[model samples]
Target: MSKGERMKTTAREKIKQQQAAQRQREKRRRVVTYAAVGVVALAAIGGGWLYAASRSQSEEAAGGDQAPVTVQSDGSVVMARSGVEKPVLDVYEDFQCPACKQLETVSGQTFKNLAAEGKAKVVYHPISIFQREPTRGNSLRAGAAARCVADGRQWLAFHDILYKNQPSETVEGFKTNDLVTWGKEAGVTSPDFEQCVTSQKHAQAQLSYADKVIKEQKIEGTPTVKLNGVALEGNVAFTPQQLRDQVTKAAK
Candidate 1:
């Protein structure tokens, strides 16, 4: 090759290298700028961030105060103070649903607090809304296990444990052994409770009841919170303080 051509090739390679270096510099600058903006935004919303964190923590701290929980014949769990039932809060939820988990995290304690205070009757309808495998099975098993102990003293504790241990939708979870173990942790010492969970004794019943309620109530999704038989708006249903306010208004 000629020296002139060689020199030209060398110059082009140098230019390409310089251009690549410039691009890298620009990318680094953009990243730093974005990080700075993120810091400013976090600082601006610090209060909101703290509130969100506290709300999540509240779920971990719930279940201390609850009224007597009674399991109805149809597999629904009812929580209410004696003879204090002016307003009813029906919470329809699928154990395997992510949004249902979020709703529980936000307002589960509110349900207990309301019922304990004789403010409302909180009826928990654990249903299976998942159509696919793994999640459908998981929901059924979990719902059945919850029903197994619903009549006992540990129903509410087991209910919270199920939510805390909810698995992902794509994979199988809430295995029989885990259910039994969690039941024991929730104070279910009855041998029948373990057998009921292991054998999935209430599985078919739970499925049938879920289907019946879905059709009768025209429920389209999980985490359906109804106040006095009327569905609550998303904003009110998912917010704990808002739910309390709405229940107070209903009681009055």
Candidate 2:
């Protein structure tokens, strides 16, 4: 072939090669775009599925039949009672408060024993004192959920479970679903308990009760103990033995 013809042929080949390369690039771009869209779609679907499952569980819990709650005159959840003549042992606590948790850990069983033996009646007033960010919302929700548990006559067990599974103070940890899970762990398997917890059914009532007790009783903080309407000396006013002794003295 002549040199000019050869050059023209080479130029045509280069153009063809360029077109092929462009096509390849476009194809790869399309693949990447499609893959990205698929990822987003899958994520959305997964998120929706999770949300639906959570809602279904909550609904099943709420719609399930359960017994009614028994409210005390002082707006406390009666955890245990031996008899009408038993001295009243009122306990004001916040679920999210570490101090309250500590008090429960230390004195819970003692109080339960006292109630069982007709020495005292233990009344739990779950209040919200940690009304700051990250803890307040969950605290109130858990408190309301406790009321639900009380309806089922499992308030003390569920209360102990909550303290046992207490999360850090920095994060809002008691998600409604989590509360239901813990309630189940605490032997609250009924649908009514789950529904009440998930819906936070007694949230407003709990808040009002807390406020009323706080105002009326002049409560300054949580884990406040009262023996027959008089506040205890301090948080550690009673060891197990000391509590028993005091109850014995009060009974006589």
Best by lDDT: 1
Q: Compose the digit string of candidate 2's lDDT tens values, residues 4-115.
A: 9999999999999999999999999999999999999999999998775543231111232222224554347664443444677888989899988877766776766665
User: In model 2, what is the error at residue 104, expressed in angstroms?
Assistant: 0.9
- 47 Cα displacement, candidate 2 (Å): 62
Global fold similarity of model 2 (TM-score): 0.67
Q: What C-alpha lDDT, on a 0 to 100 scale, does residue 15 get in candidate 1?
A: 100
Models 1 onward score TM values of 0.75, 0.67
Clashes of each: 0, 2
Q: Residue 103 deviation, candidate 1, in Å?
A: 1.0
Q: Candidate 1: misplaced stretches above 4 Å?
A: 1-65, 150-152
Candidate 2 to native Cα RMSD, angstroms: 18.7
